[model samples]
Target chain A: MQLISAACWSTYRIFVAYILSLAFGIFYGVSANVSPKREKFMIALLDVLQSVPILGFFPVAIAFFAAVFQGQRIGLELAAIFLIFTSQAWNIAFGVYETIKTLPREFGEVSKAFNFGPDFTVRRVYLPAMIPTIVFNSGVSMANGWYFLMASEIISLGNKQVKLPGLGSTMMSYLAQGNIWGVIASIGTIVLINALLQIFIFRPLVRWSELFQYNATGSAPEWPTVVDVLSGLGRALRIDTFLVSLVSLGNRAYGKVAKYVIYGIGTIVAAAVGYLLYWLFTPPYPWDILVQIPTALTVTAMRVIAAVVISVLLALPFVIRSVRNVQTAQNIYSLASILGSIPAVIFYPPIVALGGRSYMELLSILLLLTGSFWYALFNMSKGAMLLPGVLTEMSQVFNIKGWLYYKNVLIPAILPPLITGALTAWGGAWNASIVAEHVQFGDQVYSIPGIGSLLTEATSNTKALVLTVLCMTVLIVLVNMLFWRPWYSRSAEKYNITE
Target chain B: MALLDIKNLNLTFRENGKELTVLENINFSLNEGEFLCLVGPSGSGKSTILRIVSGILNQYTGEVLYKDQPNPQPNPNVSMVFQSFALIPWLTVQENIELVLEARGINPRQRVRTALKYIDMVGLDSFEDAYPRELSGGMKQRVGIARALAVEPEILLMDEPFSALDVLTAADLREQVVNLWQEKKLPLKSVLMVTHNMEEAVFLADRIIVLSARPAHIMGEVSVDLPRPRDSRDKAFEDILDKVYSMILSSRLGK
Candidate 1:
């Protein structure tokens, strides 16, 4: 019963946050596109915010919202929703903005000649244009959000944990009690809920929104039963026109002054980030334990770099095979993902039984591969399969064969999605490292001296967790600024198809 | 008296704080039952002048009077056909027409009744339920024309409406447009079309206004005196096409 209510609360919280995020993301995205200045600063700001890991801010959110709502349940719920918003909103905003920016020049003239008002444009133009991308990104964001959901539901500040009623808390408690079956049950529940959300929400939406895609081709799949019922409800209620009227009203409300109001929002967010930085450096409460976060970060960074290199080397053959025979590769990919989801911790006991003949760091590296490597395998194979037929034929036509063909013709073609997959895979490894570097399976332990272990040990103290997480965040910001941003821009400039 | 009139039109666009005039010294008027074609070389701003007249563009020094009234903002009655068709793909053909009716504050049931006539006129009666993506290029332009005609505008503005189509499709769509005009089935009176096809202008237009290269001004005007179902092989039609060809070519060199 407690589990049920927790699930309900999670659903309600997501619903509220989803609607608000979708609205604001789409609005701000279109605004950024249409606004004369292009809002490049605003776009950069969103990118930086996305790198600030949600779990890292638990101490700040819990303390701030707990006080603001006077220690209320609603306050904690709001805090969790805000954390989910951080994961969910940015890509949706970027997706909408990018879609709007890519709209044909004639569409702009059509809008002008037709005199499409802000309200009509939102309903008829922007909303329709962005829905496909928004649906896709939401699926991705939801997957990431579940990882943070586990961290958020049970906020452990100085070991005085405030447990929320959710699958996340249920899983945590079950895991702590060493009841593997109960943890499995909770995992099953979460997966079932996620599947239901996908089938009813994403599948139907993804299918429906495909019509709005600029390069839309082929027949759309049949609508799910949920869509049929919903469309019936909509028709009975005359919902489409009614929603248009409502949106236009909202549009009229924001007329002329919307940009200034948006500017005010950007300022508030900048100030909030500054304040959080200040608090992180000078925590009001001191930690009992000392954590050498910089050293830990370096240790983890080296491990991550190694994991990324190894994964690419191993995953390359599969991608190459997929480039030849796409059908078999698709089958292999789906099968592999299903097998991969069986957690690495499940096999830790057997691996540990083999003893010090194999290195402990190798065990952690293997565990990291379980969590991160599959993303690259899946994305790279898909990317390779999608390589244009003409590209391959042209290589043959030009007498380019063997490794030379792959090096000159294929490598640059697959680089964009390959890089994207690696970036996300590295991020997943960073998150999974908190578990990967230290493993406890069936009374057996295999530990490594890395930032994950540092974070795990710091969990017992409030200030240390905050300070350590803050240090990791600062390191991330620096890496993104000096390395990732430049690499991403350059890769896109060189390899990405312009038209 | 003219159905629509423009005088002393001058337009400039600022890029990196540098002002470049796009159109200048544009003067023209449309009579109640005339088909006017504005033809020129690419980048000659014939489309800009049309955009200015339709009230879609406001940053210009000009007199754009509709029936001699100086009203600004997009004139609801001044509808346009775009080169790309520009149909909202998410909406069905029927709903696309109904959307205009709804904007005009027509009742729901009545909107369907009014939309059907234009859809039938465009010969898309069977395709009212189809989306734009499902339609052919020629069929999509029919929707674009139907949509413009749906508003019951006094004058229609087409900005290179047939440029994106293949030669065969363009020819078919052109005949249908001239058929609609000749049959006098619709409320529309005059059309101000933007095109670069010298032959097409001679074929469809009552008066072809040739524009000079950018900072575009009226360079020459030729009035086609040929009858309906114009034959390109006829000496009279050939002469008209030849004259339009020279006017546009000379202007291109004059730039």
Candidate 2:
């Protein structure tokens, strides 16, 4: 019955998160599809949401929710779900927006030609086209839920740390007690549940999406049934017919309240920025608190080097193994996924028990390096192998063999994916290192002089001044410009191998 | 003597949990240096016939003979140009042609040289280093033909190779293909092509094999004895086209 209760809670929260995120996604998608002007705003909002880690808002949410729902079970649960909701929301919205915007040109023209009502158009043309995307995003949303589980369950606000009763809290409690078996059990349970859900539900849903699976050749190995079921639902509901009607009605009501809504949003954002700027200017600390600038630079340099070296070493052998033999590679991929889901914090106690705090920090840093590198290498090797068979056959025919194959064929083919994967891995490792360094269990204390540690200390101390500065200056403008800019430009030029 | 012989071929495919025969009791014999065009509407098992002969589709039950012998091996000497052009988009014109050599383990430098010769022959010498994306439809078809010939295959199977091109480009390409066949004395023992275009069949094929509607069989075969470089304006060519067109139309309307 406890298991049933847990399942029920899990299913309800998941469904609520799913539906809310989907509704938001559809609203954003419809607006983007209907109005060209709204597209940029929608995309920008989604970008900001994606870049802002949901955990970053935990402090704000905890403070707000505690005040609002002081004695309610629903309030605490809702607060816990809010972070998960935020984490899952952006991906789902982006997926829907992409689906709607990229619907076949013919469908759009047909809707216009028929002069269908806006409601009819949306119901018939748009929603049906998006079934596969919805299913795909749901799977991704569920995946994102695993990442946010621990953080959502445990929130340290001022002198009090609230622990919510869920898998996340259980893991945290076991880890804090330095109970190795308990930690293992929780991680094992979470992994098992996720694996089962993925295999049974998500995979099947994806498979049922026949419209998207038109030419089922060379589709990346997906658990397909989730998409398949979503498609079946879309068909059963006659959503395509309804979308056509909605589109027609939407066309008629296009400009109504649109300008006022835009202005209202613009005003709020401007006021927030203005307030933040004022706060920044009135800081009590010496502007030399910016000594952390060079400190950050040094940490970044160390992190990148560690990440690159470790990632390459770990990935190289696995990649080679996978390329030479596919089954081994698949096993590695599955194991990596399970490992990837288990948070860096979860590894703290075991490492501390073995090597003490300082050694654990070093070990975590190395693990961080491995985590980043393996992901990139595995993806790169897979991407290279997954290049259209016809292209591969062409390479084979050219007598491009052995080391020459790596140099001329695999290297050129996999370079872009490798770069992108490396960039993603680097981002992931940096984030992990921060949490890994700051959080410790057992008879050890470890600190890494990095942004992650800064984030940890700031949150712990309730240092709003540093938080705001880091969020605005370091996290957004500098990080994107310095780290992600070059990669984004290269991605635009080269990553379109599929087309 | 027949260069290739396919006897009582039966091909079945599953649809909605039931086995549907795509090709049944299909028999054909082709002589050396013969150009046979299999003309049919879409899904007439014309492509299936070619696939079966090429050994890509081994699900069919039948005997396909090569040089009057029971086929013990899949036809390695057969090269096919798919309806989609199937040009490896990442490869350059020269490299695309060189693929056959590389696959067969030819030296790189020599492969490039041999590849360039064919690239020039296809009037794409200037585009040798340019990827398939850079090439026009006709140019890609030229590369396709060159790749097929590079392997020195005994039989060439072209599945609507020119159908995707504009009429002028298709006609121009057809002319070049015929010219190359005449000049090179290439060891193309037989050519089996699937096309819907009546004039294309008449122009290129020695024997035009017409296929019935879906679940297709050979309706009939017409021999075009017109001389080489048969003009589109020529009366004999028009007559052959009209006859094939009427046959196809009647078959579709009602036999």
Candidate 3:
């Protein structure tokens, strides 16, 4: 009974967070693409925000919400939701923005030719065009939501901890009590929920969204009977029509005041950043905390590199096998998607128990691997699958085998997605470092010297926490701009295959 | 009065800090009950002229007049068929037609009726519920035609309508288009088509306008006075075809 209730609470939190993320994602995406001028600023801002680890927002969430609500339950709930929002919203918004940015010119012409108003165009054209992207990204966003939901439900700031009544806190309490059976049961429930969500919701959604794809070739796959029944129910209830009307109404209202709202938001964001800068540079600053940032960043960067390297090594075999066999590729994709959704936090207690203090470094790497490895595997497999068949045939005809084949053909073929995956894994490893570098079990606390550990340790001091987050954000964004972006685009340009 | 008129239409594009003139003083007219074709070399801004008349492009000098009025905005009486057959892939043939009708505030029942009528007119009688991706290139263009016609427009602008299709399909669609015009099966008063194919223009057009290469200006216009179902092998048809070809080629050579 306790487990069931806890599961419900956890599910409720995830559902609410997902809804909020979807709304903000569509709004942000549309706003970003409203004009070229806004696109530059909005895209750059999103890039910076996306690089910041989800945990980096914890201090700000607590500082604002906890202060505003005066440590009430509502404040912590909102903080938890905000943390999940940070985890899920960025990629979704990016997906929507990209869909809008790349929409075919003829569709826009058709809309204009038909004299579609803003509301009608959005309802019929823009929204439909974005549906496929939104649906695909929703699955990834939900997975991220789960990971952060587990991390956020049991928030710890120095000695003070606020635990919410969810599966995450339930599992934490079970571990604290050394109730192995209880922890296993909670994990079982989580796995069950993930399976149910995949089977009932996301699978049908993916199938349905295929209809919305432009230039979609070949016949669509058959959907399950449940989808038919659900669609029938929706039709009977006039749900689709109701939703379309709602969008039209909302867009009409938004169109009237969107300009002023954008300006208001710009002013508010500027003021907030100005205030944050002012607070950071005030006299009697935490110079000691500032001094630790460089070394801590170096340590975390090394670990992130190690994590990405290990993930690449581990994922290469699977990628090769999956590429060679279609059946194996499909199986691997399904299994990875399911396994990848399981949060790495679930394994923390077990690793802590086994390793204690001596194996902290090894266990940290293991946890980081769990967090980062799937991105490499998924992307590399996708890249390999997308390899033009003629290249392989050419290699066979030319008798290019063994190391020669891998070096010249395979390596170049997968280079773009490989780089993409590695970049994402790099970011994932950095985010995982927060939970990986520091582990707390009951009365014992295990720590490593890294930016993550520094940030976690400074949670009690809002100023120190803010400063560490800022430093990490700056470092990550700089690395992405200076290194990853250039490499990614270069590889994409060089290795692009046209069929 | 001309059904549609373009007077000194000029378009220039600013790219990489350099001003590139795309169209220079293009002039043409489409009369009621006439099939007009604009023939030119590829990238000679022939399709750009169609886009202007369709109201998809408006940043140009001079004016586009419908019924001798200064029409600058998109007119509901003007409908277009695209080279790529821009049917919304998600919507079925029926729904794609209805979408335009819906936008024009046609009631649901009337939308279905008008959409079906055009769908049947294009001989897509049983493919009402089929999405664009499911149809062949020819069928998709048929849907595009049906969609444009369902609006009951006075002017039809086709931008290389059959260029994306296989040769046999393009021939069949061209015949069907001529049939539709000759049989008065649609509410269309005039059609202005843009194509680079001299043979295609001779086969279907009542009048052909030849354009020069980039920074395009009208080189000349050829009027076809052939009988119904004009054969490409007929002497008159080939003569007009030769005339259009020479006009385009001579302009290319700065003659």
The lDDT leader among the candidates is 3
Range of the 10 consecutive residues with the lowest summed lDDT in candidate 2 chain A: A210-219
List the candidates' TM-scores in order. Answer: 0.83, 0.59, 0.92
Ordered from best to worst lDDT, the candidate numbers read 3, 1, 2
Using DockQ as the yardstick, the better of models 1 and 2 is 1
In angstroms, the error of model 2 at A209 is 5.4
lDDT of 1 at B89: 74
Ten-residue stretch with the least lDDT total in model 3 chain A: A245-254
Per-residue lDDT over A1-499 for candidate 1, one digit per residue giving the tens place of the 0 to 100 score: 7667767766666667776677667666766755444467667667666666555665677788888997788888878788767756775777677677767676667667777766666666766777666765565556545545666677653447687787777766776677878777766666667667755666666567657755444453455677788679978987556655654543443465865776688799889878866876674554433436667899998887778778777888888888746465545454443344334444454465465425778777776776568667766775676677778888889999889987887888888767766765676666566666766555666677777777777776666776777677777777767777678668867976433
Alpha carbon lDDT of each predicted model:
0.74, 0.66, 0.83
lDDT of 2 by residue, A196-313 (tens): 7656664455454423421224223443555567568977996555555444444544465855776787899899878866776575644433456457546744765587667855
TM-score of 2: 0.59
Quality class of the docking in candidate 2, CAPRI style: incorrect
Ranked by DockQ from best down, the candidates are 3, 1, 2
Best of the candidates, DockQ:
3
The 10-residue segment of model 1 chain A with minimum total lDDT is A334-343
In candidate 2, stretches whose alpha carbon ends up further than 4 angstroms from where it belongs are A1-15, A22-37, A92-141, A205-215, A218-254, A286-290, A308-337, A367-386, A415-420, A442-444, A460-486, A489-492, B1-162, B165-233, B236-255
Cα lDDT, model 1, residue A145: 59
Higher-scoring candidate on DockQ, 1 or 3:
3
